[model samples]
Target chain A: MAFEVKDVLIVLPAFNEQASIVHTLNDIDKNVPGANKLVVDDGSTDKTADYARQAGAQVAQLPFNIGVGGAMRFGFRHASRNGYKVVIQLDADGQHDPAYIPELLRNLDQSDLVIGARFAGEGDYEVHGPRKWAMGLLSTVISRSANSKLTDTTSGFRASGPRAIELFAKDYPAEYLGDTVESLVIALKSGLTVSQVPVAMRKRIGGQPSQNAWQSAVFLFRAATALIIAYMRPTDPANEPHGEKS
Target chain B: MTYFIGPILSIALIAIIVTQLMRKRLRERHALWWAIGAITTLFLSIFPGILLNLSSWLGFVAPLNLVLILGLALMLLVNLQHSAELTDLENKVRTLAEEIAELKLEDSIGKVNVSDFPESN
Candidate 1:
């Protein structure tokens, strides 16, 4: 089977992001022309799906409000079923710079997974207080478990090759299971090459941030605990056998 | 009247046993705490005088029944939270499984030969 390199799909997960979905779509169309864009509207009560569809992107409306993890899983399934050679996860709140889409896509040729590291670049952007603390705790745990340096364990901007899309589409933690960080760990443990690319992040365009101080604290505790459990759990054969295949 | 104590104790023991059995299906960490609360309630109910001194010290405002009820309420809240957590986890697993199936199909397709299809003559 011949695979075309042009079969890359950019997936955006949005929840009640009607305000910024249009701008996010425009940025992707402008920055990554000809690349297919998919928006997973996670049961947004607002007009998120309508605006996303009007913005010239395919939209997948979940039946209920699944978190970021669920939305991403939906997008991954769409990308996989449609035969996308590469899948790029872009945030719908416009914090991720779509301009770096090319750079992320370019890096995927060398690595199975390429993560856009927000903390890797020079520019300064405000990190939400709760997210900052959560990231700090997660980074420490990931560094210890994977024995790999990860500066931005929680950044939503990421690019995955066919291999990664397959792995994540299968076992991606969908509910408060530390999706991004856990995916990274799974990819590394499976011997899939992982790399980080520096990308500039912008402030959110609209809508209140998903979590407040109390919610963020709770999320942080849950996410950190999930990561710890994942680290200690026995590795499944499906994940380990891939290493032998490679 | 003295024999009443024996039947009350037996009923409390049965309640405790039933709750312990039900705890196996409950995911909340507070179930164990609630069990403790129940046992405490039973003990205090059997010997009402044990709480008499404490109740008097608090001006009888902090009645023993109020304390037991509060503990039971807390346990109920925790159990509710646990149920919510379990539901969330189950939903996550269902979605994950669906996504995984889709990806596996894509992976298998990559290894197949599409050229086998005949071109128009």
Candidate 2:
């Protein structure tokens, strides 16, 4: 698929990333050039929305923090409405290196969804403590479910094709599990082909991750349970009120 | 005694819920469910034998245990219902926020193309 600025929309769901959003937006403009850019400022109390607006990306200012899933949903909706064929999800924190965006989009030729998996080939990302263990457990569960080799179940850097975009725009997990693990599960179950590309992520350029070590531990447990429940839920077209739009 | 304590507590609970419902502080749908709960507790408290008999049929040996377990189960269901309602409200708030943001952008950019959307609060 040829990457066109008008045809591709890179959605960065940001929360309190005022310091990093401008840099992230700049990277997209510099790296991808023609891809339309959008920032879903997930109800940041900080000036994240303002900074993104100033940076010239179309901004969707969420009144409050609605988590990544809700923000991604809005992103896909904007893509479908504005006639973009490819939508890429990036992090506002600048961890997701925009340098690999071309490779991710290229892989979209073989897959409906392309995720920038952190540990796929291992460049330099390190994980230890309870966090490492949680990722390992999640990787195992998600890989087993998706029936594909996936190294990073939590990587937010991803690309979506038209089919994946419209499905998510109607309904995506709006909370903790929706952003990562369950999203892939829902996509795979809904008949969208998913693949992962090896990408080395950079460290955060601004604000801390949404959760600390302790909160992540709690989140890990909750995410595991939600993933189990989500598996039982088959993505039925009848379940959604909206129908048939790409 | 069960007479003075249980009935009075149930009546008091029902009265509070009823007043809230009448004042429109609580939704009628939710209040109706709570009213059923208050009335069930009142009935079970009045005729403890009904619970004891039902518990025995369900293979429970202790009536108090049955009462407490049932009460806990009902409370859990109510909590689950609240969670569902909360999730719905969260989605609504998000949609409203995004819609307003889009409108603000259109207004500032002088596009004025969003007249189709109903004005949202």
Candidate 3:
């Protein structure tokens, strides 16, 4: 069956991404035809919100910079409220390829959550060495604990259907770790299907990536603890049978 | 001199408890760093000569005050980050609440619209 573009919404959680937001928006518009774009500008000091809006995408300008997790929560809530059947999360840094969106969305038909896994295919991706090691170790631990097959648990590019959106909208870990591992764990515990599709990642367009050496170490420590807690805690209320009224 | 040790130990115990209580309310990320900072300060306080020697290595003219200020500043930054996080969480909660209200309204409207239809035979 052909996918309906109107049912899909692209969410960009941007923070100080003025230099790249326009390009990212244009790329998504050109590639993902008819898919509505929503850019949640996380209190950018530049013209990120203006440029995104002018580029023919919806804009949600936050009052302050709430980090990536906070921005994503806002995007998820917006997507849920606006009746979007599937919401694809794309980074504002222009590192993600819009052409691969169709592939990610395709997997959504079979899975509740579809992630763009950069490590799945037989290709050389330019991920930083330290980050790769950390992500590998983290994903391994998370997959083993959650009883799920996860290759790239730290990738930001993900597509979520309504079920996934409802689960995320209620309780998402809002921090620097992004919605990678946390979302997968939630989906699995909720009995929702989760899968990954191979997609190549590129170097960021402008500005430095958020994870520096110090920050990455900090994130690893924090995310590991959060993951353990998430694994122990109950899934969101919506995930439970009695809580599925929505 | 012996009596001084008792009061110092009491003060140290009180400080540790107070810091731990504060840590409980902090976000996990900030709390970890804060705990580290508090423990380090407590350690240096118990062994004041460590700061004095480290300061000499760093070429600080007066190591005691410098070390104390630096530790305080680090803790302050962590506190600031925590405050910012709380504000962000508050805003997010407000936004989620508004969205929930809207969703409930739409759901009720849909229910009412369905009820308005005529009864089937």
Highest lDDT, which number? 2
- lDDT digits (tens) for residues B1-121 of candidate 3: 7536634764675576567667784345655665666577667667778888988888889886677788688878878877998878876675664344334334443633434448722
B-chain TM-score, candidate 3: 0.59
Which pairs clash inside model 1? A170-B100
Candidate 3 at A143: error in angstroms? Answer: 2.8
The weakest ten consecutive residues by lDDT in model 2 chain A span A237-246
Query: What are the per-residue Cα lDDT tens digits for candidate 3 across A1-246?
Result: 235899888989888888899999989979987778888777789999789878988777666665677667767776787788888999999989999899888888888888888888834674565566677777787667546567888889999888888878876766446367676677677877777788888888988756677776766677677677767887556577345464
Q: How do the predictions measure up, each by TM-score?
A: 0.67, 0.84, 0.66
* DockQ for each numbered candidate: 0.08, 0.54, 0.05
**CA lDDT, every model vs. true structure:** 0.74, 0.82, 0.75
Query: Candidate 3: deviation at residue B109, Å?
Result: 21
Report residue B60 deviation for candidate 2 (angstroms).
8.2
Native-to-model Cα distance after best TM-score fit, residue B22 in candidate 3, in Å: 25
Worst 10 residues of 3 chain A by lDDT: A122-131
Candidate 3 chain B — worst ten consecutive residues by lDDT sum?
B100-109
The digit string of per-residue lDDT tens for model 1 on B1-121 reads 9737744875676576676667675434545666666677667767767677777776766676666666778778868878997987787666754444344333434643344447622
Q: A52-133 in candidate 1: lDDT tens per residue?
A: 8788877666667767777777777777767788988998999899888778878877788888987776458556777788
The residue pairs that clash in candidate 3, if any, are none
